[model samples]
Target: MFEKILIANRGEIACRIIRTARRMGIKTVAVFSDADANARHVRLADEAVHIGPAPARDSYLAIENIIAAAKRTDAQAIHPGYGFLSENEAFCRACAEAGIVFIGPPVEAIRAMGSKSEAKKLMEAAGVPLTPGYHGDDQSPERLLKEADAIGYPVLIKAAAGGGGKGMRRVDTREDFLAELASCQREALSAFGDAHVLIERYVVRPRHVEVQVFGDTHGTCVHLFERDCSVQRRHQKVLEEAPAPGLTGKRRGEMGRAALEAARAIKYVGAGTVEFILAPDGAFYFMEMNTRLQVEHPVTEMITGLDLVEWQLRVAAGEPLPLKQDQLAFRGHALEARIYAEDPSKGFLPSIGKLLFLSMPADGAHVRVDAGVDEGDVISPHYDPMIAKLIVWDETREKALSRMRAALADFQIAGVASNIGFLSRLVACGAFAQANLDTALIERESAVLFPPEAPPPDEVFFLAALTQILGEQGVKGCGRHDGWRLNGAFSRAMAFRCGEFENTVEATYLVEIYRFALGKRSVSARGRLTGKMIAAEFDGQHVQAVVVAACGALNIFLDGAAHKLEKLDPLDVAAEGGSGHGGLLAPMPGRIITLLVEPGEKVEKGAPLLILEAMKMEHKLTAPATGAVRAFYCVIDDQVAEGAELIDFEPETI
Candidate 1:
């Protein structure tokens, strides 16, 4: 085995690889950018080296920097954990030339399966079940549109070299085909430097299922069963489970055989995933193969009781295949949730900042977490926003779903927006539980999953009320929320805690408390609690639910598992909710990359005033009307906290 390995990615996957490397008694090296200097992955590795600045082009994607870091750390191998360089054939070849092993599939397999169009042609030649589509090399838009017309109105335009929903678009009609095609090609060009696209029949309500295949240098390949990743949003998998719930025995065998054949067609080595779109008629069509480890690989490991990372290392070290296809036995069901730092209401935009509070669930024999973050870890805009992967295993699918719901409720995070509420409801919904839904489930019912919270202003006022009472009543703000019956009776006391301190307060039912603090004095605050939530005042201004509870917990409830205390209490109470001019500005947690205006600069209504890059995307805060910039408080590249003023404008004269 290699004594030292360099992880060539960031975030959870890099951290995940380092963890397994440690257990195997191998030394691990981590490479990072300026933005990731304080990131979790760097902290956990045995050694770390600065590669470059934040942008992926300058850092994570720079093959020279990665090779240099590996050489400097004396790493015998480079593990391109998922994203950046993991599937780049040239990177793999470079490593081979450098005499450093690349801990993944051989370069030949990467180049063969990297392009969706070529991979489809190769699969057809190899006699694997193929999807009906156009994988030709013609770059002319006119030619591609004609192919789509022949295929039918509904077709999927996917990047020849894309993954993770970046360069994929679905067209429902011929009229929209041209526009969507251009968009897809543009995204593909920017994201992958390849604008080649292919068209495939858009399977209605498609269930994304993939078989995990592993091969060794000794020429043996085996299947670790499959993962059903139908629960998704924006073409990205949100919830994944192994041993597809409704899969027939014959279908499972078919999928396994197809996956192994696909691997053999390319002489694949190391771990890879062969994805397929399962249809309602029990038929499946080939999708592209993931050349590196998958984010959802934990589910496969849970059912098979195998460490895929370990298998990858063993295979790369020239070890023969340890298990045969027949020896692999899948027992029970396993589910995995991709917990992300994103706002479900705001179109799932990535969220970033310090993790003020975090409580991870205990991992027993059957539970596993492939996370690289710690409580104090800062989620920077420099990388993917996934906080962690919480996986559960049980003997039955129903049990796995129930366990997942409960686990999501118990999982806690603060200081930034997240999709915990969105994920919890998704797993518990009848559609998901029934396992009959597909890719369109989220799109057709997008509004259902992220129903608008009551108006933000109303929530804001309610929080202000709670904070006022909390200040006046000490630990007994409960009285403000409790109502007397017509006969004047009935009250209960809730014990509120601030870290190690706890206080009991008297109140009527459903007056949810947010935070209670006892210093020289005590303060308590509550918001209306209802429907599996304790809606509370957060941060003295924003009204939000801090804790989402088990739906059953409503029947026998105390405090909700989600906490709202910290967002509500500022260290300097006097500084809470300072003045704002009523236009959306950076709330409190990012940097202003550029000030697009100056004082006295006239702009049209809703025109861009400044662009803020937070969570790795640029957001333009616009002018409310045709007005002049009366004041400006930020400069280009200013590190402004949330709520920092960027531009203030005066109403335009008629």
Candidate 2:
């Protein structure tokens, strides 16, 4: 084994590599940008290096800084832990020229598989099953349009070097193709610095499944089963599982062989993934090859009981393949959920801020958490918004899913808005439960998920007011102290807003917490001014809670978790930039960088509502249902506070 290796990446993957490297008795070097100066990975590594500024291009992607840091630390090898410079052919070549081992596939392999266009051509020549489309060298818009027309009206415009669903667009009509193609190109150039693209037949009801293959310099290679990444949103995977639920033994064998054959054709070494888009017709088409570790690799690792990163290092060190293809076995089922700092209600826009109350679900032998942030840490706009990847394993797929749902409910974060609530609802959807889901699952069911106006349960607000009054109980006696007043001051009027609508809560705190007129729910809670918690006893069950600040904005901690609610201002004037509610609301607090919509415009339900640049990715807010834009509430350069209403729907005709 190498003496030391520098992790040329940041966040959870960097932390993941360091753990395995440590187990192998190897010293690890962690590189950090300004935003990640106090990151978990930096603290865990044996030594750390300050690379550059907070921006990824200046820091994580800077080859010179990375090389200098590696040499200064006397590191023998550099592990490009997925993303950043992970698949950059120039970086791999630079490592070779600098006399430092790059713990990945050879530079030749990286270059051959880096560009999707070239990779498609290479794979076709190697006789790998490919989707019928255009993967040519032409960059002319006219030529690309002609190719798309020749292929079909419904075609996929994909970036030559794309992942994470960036720089990808699907067109269903000829008129839309030209416009969407241009948009895809612009996004592609911005994301990958590559304007090249290819068109493919968009598979209807597609299932994204990939094979994990590994090779060594000794000319040995093996395939480690496959992972079903069918559950996706915006063409990006939200959940992944090992041993594809509906795949038969024959289909699994065929995919495994095809993956191995593709690897052999490329003479690939180190860990690589061959992705395929499986259509409803029971036929599969090669999407492209990923020349580095995958974000969803944890699920595969759990099922196979193999340390893929350690294997990457061993293979890069010229070790022979540890196990043959047949030796690799799939044990129990494993599933992973990507926990992102995003708001599902606001079209899944990224959220950024301090993690005031960060808590991960408990971990055990079957559960694994690959996280990057902790409590009090700031989630800046300088990097990806993925807070963590939670993985669960069990003897059966259903068992794993059951464990995951329970864990998700227990997972908590206070300051920033997250997709936990949305994800919880998605996995529980009827179609998802039956596993009859596809790529269009999210889009088809988006209306139900992203309701135009969320119904504010007045009961919940009433409960909050009642809970608030109980929390203000200042009785001196400690044990079961109810608000027993010698004097008769029973009712306290308070204002609160659910979203745009305002409500006045008349709370009576005479005996137990009670609502006005509505008979006392007879709720009693006792909390001390100190750190002790309070619980409401009702029907032999306790609603455990903690109240932090005894002030105007009620900072509350309910059900062993904390949250904030401001005192609603009934007299506050509504801002002109938007309706009281409608268009696109800021899911969580974030600044708006660009505007994509205007008033009196006709927009498809899924049209770009606006471009909210946050948590590092541009979240394109789309229409909820096809409607004419009556109003826009935000400006182009507005700094939108979280949950600030940005659009308004026309009043319904009676």
Question: Which predicted model would earn the best lDDT?
Answer: 2
Tens digit of per-residue lDDT, candidate 2, span 489-605: 466566765446466766565544343432344333322234434455433444555443333444454443334556776566677764433545776555565556677777766
Query: In each prediction, how many residue pairs overlap at the backbone (N, C-alpha, C within less than 3 A)?
Result: 9, 6
- Summed over model 1, clashes come to 9
lDDT of candidate model 1 versus the reference: 0.77
Show pairs that collide, candidate 1: 474-522, 539-567, 539-568, 547-562, 587-642, 587-643, 588-642, 588-643, 589-642
Give the worst 10-residue stretch by lDDT in candidate 2.
518-527
TM-scores, all candidates, are 0.77, 0.87
Model 1 regions lying over 4 Å from their true place = 452-654
Query: How far out, in Å, is residue 591 in model 2?
Result: 11
lDDT of 1 by residue, 620-652 (tens): 678877878877777776887766666676767
